[model samples]
Target: MRPVSVRYDNSSVRVCMKKKAMCKIGLAVMLLLTPMMGWSAKRLNIVIIVGDDWGGPYASAYTGIYGRNLPSNVVKTPNVDRIAQNGVLFKNAYVNAPSCTPSRSSIFTGRYFFNTGGGAVLGGTWDFTIPSFPLLLLDAGYHIGLTSKGWSPGTPRNAPFGGTAHYYQYFGTSVSSFSKSVTKWTAKGMPFEKAKQTMLDQVRGNFEAFLADRKPDQPFFYWFGPTNTHRTWVKGSGKALWGIEPDSLKDQLPVYLPNNPEVREDMADYLGEIQALDAYIGVLLKKLEEIGELDNTIIVATGDNGPGGFPRGKWNLYDFGVATPLVVWYPHSTGGRVVTDFTTLMDLAPTFLEVAGVAIPPKTDGRSLLNILTSPLSGQVDPQRTFAITGEERHNAKARDDSLPYPARALRTARYLYIRNFAPDRWPMGCPYVAAHVPYVFHDIGEPSPTYDWIITNRSIPSAADYFTWAFAKRPAEELYDAHKDPGQINNVADDPMYADIKKSLAEKLLAELKKAGDPRVIGDGGTFDRPPYTDLKTVACQDTIPLNWAPGSHH
Candidate 1:
């Protein structure tokens, strides 16, 4: 297999795109006037703001109009929703995988999670063979920079996101631990509002510094990733900071989650973190506006994935786990349009390249969305944009006894959601216990929170029992759900005779697609990912090279 086309998915694309950009672009830089009315920037800038564990339906942009009864209506995301109002809001956007490393891997390489080899799982290293789009953009003479968490849980040897060359984080990244840091600040008699802003100022300061360092008329690509929306948020922060009452989410929760106070309050705190993320987004938006570059830049905002430490979220293949809120505000594009096209976060790579006039590298799976964004019409602009293929291999490597991955792939279509769990006997989430108490006993769901702890200790309670099984129990070999009928994805119809035909069709489609993508799981022995460096959970990444026997990109 010789790791087919490692160039485009990793560092090679950097070399190739740089040549293309150099040939096409002139050496001279053009200056934009400072004033808003007369600002004359030469090229479009790219700004991608990623939220940690943020989901699609959380924004008011999505829930404000529809899903009005949903829990997201408890909080308002004016800044994030503003991007929707000013541009196109994606109705369905998913990550290739749920875990942070793998999802970010897919987004970076514009390929399926499996194609990234060791990059396909958490605690996995960067497959240097995979080309990062941001690196390509940087190579093509785009002034690029990154702030906050870019790629995580693994050290990218090739410095996938430019290895701190364009990195700018002078103030601090304390905003990631939003509640904890804010608590520390406020505990010292700092005002709550000031304490919160004290953390958010890091976001503002770092972005401004990146902007300041950029050359005039140099089309820039900046990534702002904040993990505040992740777990370990302040319990009462929802009500105290954002005025969201936990009881307000009483009846709005999905059927998978208990509507009890402890659960509601925990979720409310998560929402508060989302609100905090929205505020940071507001800071970025304001900075762009101040520089008269708000409309000049192609602003894309989304989370790496959905919520963590929640039922059927993050580590699961469910929609809440994979689906991300995609809002793109292009300067000359139509606004207020909800595009229902099935798009993955991977698509942003090609979209950025196409807009920047940089040639997209070969062997990339992402299709450019420039056409859809530039179009005035909405809803299914591309008929070929029908479905998304999402899956997960491993979260915490030692999740299972042998460090085996719970390999699963899914085909999410317009009306149906079908999944095939290859390792059905193993826990889809991490194991109930681990070799050591590193990521806690329940490694995957180890983040300490009310809902997580409560579910663990009170799994036998009648009110919490069903959710426990729904969230943690090992899944069957196949699972099918009627998305139209059960939006929460609670009902599994894979075994139901009524859905027999549907299940068969979906399973076949998923397998064929995985095979075409050269997924190691569906090809040959399907044991490549099951072995080391992916299963080498002891280190942040594997030190040894992927042996020849563990061919990653083998194809038919």
Candidate 2:
């Protein structure tokens, strides 16, 4: 509409006047919108659902294998699939470390695992001095609460980080009791199927209770850490609860695992646990919707690391060990898209802080994913997100008297994975002698699962020997894989002359990035990671004399 206009002294002055008028109008609109936007300008209720030891490929939505191939089996995750349909699914998400403590620490602090002092190792204490995103949210006036596992499998005793302060006091069923409760229910005349369902329901009930207790008018942050996908699943759970018979899954076994019926059954059980977790996620989503907070809340569902207690999966630098499924749903913005940008758990802390309008600390190693999250574009939203860095320090302290650390740093790109084993002489997994001798040992493969038993029992067989070697044998100093050509990462092309240039470039880049990040391994103080005052009583003993020409300052 051609309305009355004021004349200006010059065109530039008129433009400035127009901009000032628009700014004033924007400020007035923002002030009016403040109440609906919560206490702060970017206040958003955050719900992060973390599945313990779950991997990306297990998600039906990511692979489309669960529903299409195993329709009769009840390991279907229609609910989680729904989230992917309604939100942004990240295809190339990973954790900084494959272990529990380090992975969680990275997510909480927005720092690399190696940079986190004691947090770099399993059963080690997290340096509470590093700021946690949840604590920051709490200080920002958001009601924070966590259910099931939080930053755990590690002691948070005297640390200034005050573990309890991160979450508001909320009562819920303990995740530790999940096994006992299922056993008790089964013994009390309930069918194994019904008992398993009851156990999952209890977890969902805890989350519901947390939501119910949230104060009105206060934005909330809740960490829903579910133990459903963790190791030690009830034996025969797949058949008992989900009708997923072991024999029925012969054709669907993953390429990485042995195709025996036993391994298939284990896979089924694992899938059942993931399905149970997905069920709870569905319940949580429904609860949010019922309470009218779904639109305003940012729901992020991911796993801490890869699948646990499997060969070459968890506690290793393989893709299966570090790659995680990341699905983020913020209904008000950025939904129904698939992002292939490389993402690490380290990025989550800064992302959460950014969403809450809180300042991200300067020392953080992670870059915020706000741009990728809110962008309309799909694959590779950020050009800089081309690669992810992953490493491992000490996973299980109960391996031997030495509690040796398996230190390996890896750089993963869309095309290749480059790994540098700081101590190539040390076993990638634990020493086989210690593994065979130690009763109830928490070796690199993790808890005594069927896969561990199978590998150990069948080690004499040629095929089993090959599998064991691939999973546990000592690796070379430098190893590289063409990830695109070899998704299983079984073939090593590091020494292959054809790929020398790629290997050299990646190695140089990896070293530069590590140095820039202030990684202790690159610095001269890496030896401190191996020595003294371990949280576990088992001391770290060097089996061989430290080599005269060994990498200086290298530890566990």
| Top-lDDT candidate index | 1
Q: List ranges where model 1 is wrong by over 4 Å.
A: 1-41, 64-68, 434-440, 537-556
Over 346-381, each residue of candidate 2 has an lDDT whose tens digit, in order, gives 999889878876657658899998888788878889
lDDT of 2: 0.73
Query: Deviation in angstroms for 190 in model 1?
Result: 1.8
Task: Tell me how far candidate 2 lies from the true structure as C-alpha RMSD in angstroms.
Answer: 10.0
Q: TM-scores across all candidates?
A: 0.89, 0.84
lDDT of each: 0.78, 0.73
**Tens-digit lDDT track of model 1 for 232-299:** 78888888777889999987887888788888998888888888888898998999889898878999
Clashing pairs in 1: 9-130, 9-131, 10-130, 10-131
lDDT of 1 at 26: 27
- Ten residues in sequence with the least summed lDDT for candidate 1: 30-39
